[model samples]
Target: MKVPVKVDGRELTLSNLNKVLYPDYGFSKAEVIDYYTRVAPVLLPHLRGRPLTVKRYPNGVNGQFFFEKNTPEHTPAWVRRANLPAPGSTKNRERIDFAIVDDLPTLVYYANLAALELHVPQWRVDEDGEALKPDTLVFDLDPGAPATIVECCEVALMLREVLQVEGLTARPKTSGNKGMQLYADWDCREEPSVYAKRLAQFLEKERPKQIVSVMTKKARPGKVFIDWSQNNPAKTTVAPYSLRARELPTVSTPLTWEEVEGCERPEDLVFTAPDVLARVEKRGDLFGRA
Candidate 1:
């Protein structure tokens, strides 16, 4: 069914309201849009002015999915677009027209298309649509098989201390899947990836049994891989508060350092859409300072 709605004075036509996006939980497409709309207050700040990459699951999580870097031709005229040089561009496609979801109307439009996951770079674009220097350093802690979010929590605490010595405060968030990520407000002077890689390597050396800094898959089993490569200007990590296109609608929810420290099970950090909304209502934006 097609439902015409006006969101923040922008007219939008939403469709497939009853279609189930998460079959296992019976979560519908309409519910997905509702979740984003309710969570948009805090979610917009992180997305505003940033180049967005949307992972669209048109046929639900069980079906095929595609990552959309370029805004579709049918994108609403009011939805802001950022024209920036494509990373590793081919001859025909030298630049990418990325959608900048700066407000509620734009966000609801994307959600209408079943764009479950929104990823953005560490840096925001200037008024001229030029990419700025990285302002945040991120470490994507991914656990290989036999390791889980519980293990990631232990490593996140270790990372927090090491970053504290550098006079930077690290913020923690679940990846909404099997991992977690820590982000720190960085000084824009130096390249963030260089520092992130160095820190990752240092931790890997100091805690060889628990951490793996390299990208090699063979070394990851029973260890949490500190994926420091996502700090690059071209790289994008999943936006906080955005839902993951998993079997269930899990959100990339922020956590208090206490929650990170106290986590003992994999499910302890796992938060679904409903859980996240409730947390937001109770605690507000946990990552607001970052």
Candidate 2:
């Protein structure tokens, strides 16, 4: 069924409202759209002016999924886009017109497409669509099998101490999967990506058994891989408050430092769409405070 709705003065045609997108939780596409609409106030700020890469699960989370970097040709004219040079593009013509979900209408459009995972780089673009310096740095704490979010939490706390020593305040958020990520301000850092790499390496050396800095999958088992690569200009991390393509409708919800220190189990930090909405209503944007 298609429904015509006007939001923020824009007319949009939404479809597949009754289709179940998260079979495990019986969460439907309509619920996804509603989640994005209600969470727009907090989610939009993290997405505005950043090139978005969405993980689309058309048939549902149990079905196949694909990543979308280019804005669809049928994208509405009013929907904002940032024309960025393709990662390895040598020619001017090789560019991707990526969507920028800066408002409720655009957010709904992506949600309607089953774009459950919204990924963005740490940097934002200028009015001319030129990339700006990254405003934030992220440490993507991915736990290899045998390890869980509890292990990630231990590493996150360690990272928080190091960042504090650098006079930077680190914020925590769940990956909405099995791990967690830490974010901090990056303005004064000489090179955010380089610094992140060095920091990860340092941590790996300090706690050889608990952390792995390299991207080698073979070395990941039973350890937390500190993914510093997300700080690179070309890479992206899942946006806070965006849903993951998991069996359940899990959201990448932000956390308070106290929560990070107290997490003892993987399930302790997992949050669904309804959980996140309620969290925002009560505590507000914890990440924004950093």
Candidate 3:
């Protein structure tokens, strides 16, 4: 059943308010919508002008899920959408109309659809329909067995030092799961693909044993794969403050450099939905500059 609601002077129809989306935590669809509504002030800024890919978990976190690239045809007319050429498809000139979550109502609308995770590219769309230069460089640190987020944190510190030498400041965040991601806001004059590949090659050469620049799982055992590949124009990272479709409703949370260095275990930096909302009340947007 759908119910009419008003958010920031926008009228939206919210559905499945009582459905449990996080079984382990007994978190309902209403709670999810509420969380996004509360975090919109901080979250919407990161989402503004960027095409979003909604990862839907319609039947809850443990059920099957799929990614929706083109905005659904049923999207309300008031919701903003961006039409852009699909990335890396030379033959297909067809453009994808992506949903732009620029306000509280749009964010709530997706939440009601059980679109638990929102992902966006590092670059933003411009008035001429061209993608702007990437404003951030990201390193997705995925630790293999025997190496956990603790190991990722250790590597993140080293990665920070390397970035510092390049005159960049890095910010660390829990991947809302079993990894860590570090980002640096940059003003480079290079395409994201070129810059990311170059940095990946450089890091691989600098720490060949500790960091695997390649994407193969075979090479990842006991090492944190510095997934620099996500810096491409086509790729998207989990939006900061967005909820992860996990059993416990964890969030992709930003962290202080001090917290990153002090993390001895994954649990030290893990944050749930409520925890994230409270943190925002106290700390505001930690990734505001990025």
Q: lDDT of model 2 at residue 171?
A: 89
Best by lDDT: 1
Regions of model 2 farther than 4 Å from truth: 89-93
- TM-score for candidate 2, please give it: 0.97
lDDT of each: 0.93, 0.91, 0.86
lDDT of 3 by residue, 83-166 (tens): 888965444647888888878888998998999999999988786556777888888989988889988988899888887887
Number of clashes in every candidate structure? 0, 0, 0
Off by over 4 Å in 3: 88-93
What's the lDDT of the predicted structure labeled candidate 2? 0.91
Instruction: Enumerate residue pairs that collide in model 2.
Output: none
**lDDT at residue 250 of model 2 (Cα atoms):** 96
* Per-candidate RMSD, Å: 1.1, 1.7, 1.9
* Candidate 2 residue lDDT tens string, 1-290: 89999989999999989999998899999999999999888988889889899999999999999888887789999988888888764334478998888888899888999999999999999988888988999999999999999999999999999999989899899999999999997884588878999999999999999999998999999999999989888889999999998888999999987888899888899999999999999988887946
How far does residue 264 in candidate 1 sit from its true spot (Å)? 0.9
